[model samples]
Target: MGHSRFRRSIVHVNATLARVVGDEEGMSTAEYAIGTIAAAAFGAILYTVVTGDNIVSALTGIIGKALNTSVG
Candidate 1:
């Protein structure tokens, strides 16, 4: 009888703890939404910079220099 009561008390305590601690499912959804927006904005900015004439010409110059280097 005493052991049975102790077991029930343990179950009750666990239930109470679960209620207090809850879950992070909602928080995870919100965080993912914000992160996705930020990543998309960053990607748009990067695409603009990479596609500019200045960046293209600079990269072309760098590659040209590397390809033309004479072996010592």
Candidate 2:
């Protein structure tokens, strides 16, 4: 009797786990949310670096050099 009860409990637990594992209702939404947050963070970092004074000066210097070059 105890053996039978233990087997039933194991089966019940397995069934519950299977149901939980098979359910993927909000997985896509969660993945999309994480991806969006990562993208936003990356964009913010890129914007900050590009808008910094050092980058601005480097870009300005490169442009000045390009414009000052003469065509032979």
Pick by TM-score: which candidate is best? 2
lDDT of 1 by residue, 1-72 (tens): 255774575565555445434554555655556555655655665576679898899999999999999999
lDDT of each: 0.64, 0.66
Query: Candidates' TM-scores?
Result: 0.53, 0.57
Q: Which stretches of model 1 miss by more than 4 angstroms?
A: 1-30
Most lDDT-accurate candidate: 2
Q: Relative to the unseen true structure, what is the C-alpha lDDT of residue 64 in candidate 2, on a scale of 0 to 100?
A: 100
Which residue runs does candidate 2 get wrong by more than 4 Å? 1-26
- Report the CA-based lDDT of candidate 1 relative to the real structure: 0.64
lDDT by residue (tens digit), candidate 2, 1-72:
255774575565556445544565765666556555655655665577679898899999999999999999
Worst 10 residues of 2 by lDDT: 13-22
